[model samples]
Target: MSVKGVTPIENTLEINWQGDQKSIYHNIWLRDNCHCSECYYPITKQRLLNSATIDINIKPKSVNVKEGKVEIVWDTDHSSTYDVDWLRIHSYNPRLIPLDKKLKDDDDVLKQKLWQVKDIKDDLPQVDYNKIMQSSDETDNEEAIKEWLLQIHKFGFSLINNVPISPTDTEKLCEKLNYIRPTHYGGFWDFTADLSKNDTAYTNFDISNHTDGTYWSNSPGLQLFHLLYHDGKGGTTSLVDSFKCAEILKAKYPESYEIFCKIPVPAHSAGEPKVCIQPDIPQPIFKLDHQGKLIQVRWNQSDRSTMDYWENPEDVIKFYKAIKNWVEIITSPENELWYQMKPGQCLIFDNWRIFHSRSEFTGQRRLCGAYFERDDFISRLKLLTLGREAVLDSI
Candidate 1:
């Protein structure tokens, strides 16, 4: 977007774009967004000026536009320049962006493509571990890693093949994400069915489909599972797309879905004697944003501590019915995806939208993996999916 001309009217700058489109920017908005060294710190890219201190009626004394840039000299003798692409991306003019497309400041920008059991059967996202490790730059010439991350973003999971079946290579692969999220079990875990931690994950029980870290306020976002060794029989892993299940429940059992969305479920982690973990604020099984878009799905009956949240006995009955329906939808044989993970296969999935479980097994088994902070993982995804400049434009 190149600026063709600018007109100041009633303390607002109206920019006439080269493509016959125009945008309106208030004087106060421009004055508050000065990009000078004193006004904005370049290294941090954070504003140094307090927006509240700027005068609301501030006007620019002069305006200049040249070479896809806009320059303005304000009445306070402050000068600022803006890249036209930034202005186009942040344009608030109704001509450019409709009311329905307007996004809240904190709303998630990534779009999702929900999947089913048969959707990815023949072409499940699988990336070569060697190709991902060959590239040092995560953002450039790394389509393999980007596609792997994109699959997780779109379908909630991706499998990385031939990971060398060792903690060292797994740790190196995770470090490419920048950091590992430490948990009650610790960071960069390597354990077998020795019950090192006091959790169901430490046993060879037939664990039902559930999301991990339901007991914490901010649960782990990305969970990596690498089957290093498992010679025993009858321990196949399964995953269910909880987002898809939620939609099915909403369509089939509207009442139960509403109850699950509105009601809160309490969960606690009391495995460790001195380390009890619980969420300060209880969350619903189906979490939605202000726009009613599903943002999270927290369903873990194993970790649920008590059902004492509601006072109405009828609500309790409805919740029970809801959970029953929810369980059926998630556990249905048609919806579940069973996999016999091989020794060199590594499965990384989104903990927020995917439910994982394992069937009971015999003999010894060893696995190694790590947890990733949601922000850190998404940061890499955004950068890899969209280049630095594109990310800035989207913001």
Candidate 2:
């Protein structure tokens, strides 16, 4: 029974959404999403009624539009009102055109200003710690904190100066935004030049440019490192915008780019000294969405294990060449950003987009840092900053 136009018949309610588009809503569905006091709690914004308890054949005695609201009076003597805008935003009509091409336009909503070292050399998106931090009793400074998060969300990295030079302070800072995502090493981990430690980060060695947690399926998103103590020399923290390097690779060598995007490189944490019992995960150096948009870049030459998934020698040869080409591009001086992190300075970077490393140093260089879940970071960003409307004006 196709609807001719917007009308409330015996059981169905058809809405004339746009010029020639009509969206149909059933009586039951309209009741389920009812914003009435009895149906939904106004304070908690939680639904009070159990969905299963609602009658499947429930009918509306009367339905009419008044002052931009759809008023519905059920046969059970319950009245409900729905704003037109709310219904429009949550409409699910297959024939109705979607707002955007992407299902979740969250990433696009950020309006991320991607860049290389040279792009941000003169004007790094740095903010003071006081802007983000809040007292126990006081509320957060909305605009300042929003700007701080906007910087990180846009640039894939940000610097926070005047952070407290204390253990777990980096982790505490993340609390202002979100919780710390725990890993095999532990949350709020501290690393220093220790001969007894198993990981290279614990030693004064020159670590090549790489993103952490390549072996895991759900890699950590945000990494915050606070240089609590760094009396050492030559231990300059190096960062490379892997996304920028990836674009370069995509343009120069499309074949290698294809291999890098398709081939699943094997990696495991068990191979690294004492970090054992971890599952082997296979992922491409470059991961793309279904629409062929670059989503993430996972690269760590040191952590990558010998992958025998593809027996074809030609495929294997091409995979190695792709990895080599990507590595060369990232390690190139033109892409590297060097910064000698001092005490009380915190570096926050995206683990999915930025490849980070440190140069070899002589003396002590203790740092406390923590990882934040990607989902939580994105969730916070949506609520605090302007949502889809932020990018709507650009359209």
Reference-based lDDT, each prediction: 0.83, 0.77
* lDDT (Cα, tens digit) per residue for candidate 2, span 83-121: 765565556663343443232454465666767777888
Model 1 scores a TM of 0.88
Q: Model 1 off-target regions past 4 Å?
A: 1-24, 63-65, 93-111, 138-141, 311-314
Q: Which regions in candidate 2 have their CA more than 4 angstroms from the true location?
A: 1-15, 18-66, 70-82, 91-109, 135-140, 271-274, 277-281, 311-313, 387-395
What's the TM for model 2? Answer: 0.78
| TM values, all candidates | 0.88, 0.78
Candidate 1 residue lDDT tens string, 280-347: 98889888988698888998989998877686778988998998999999988767999888888899
Q: Give the best candidate by lDDT.
A: 1
**RMSD (CA, angstroms), candidate 1:** 3.6
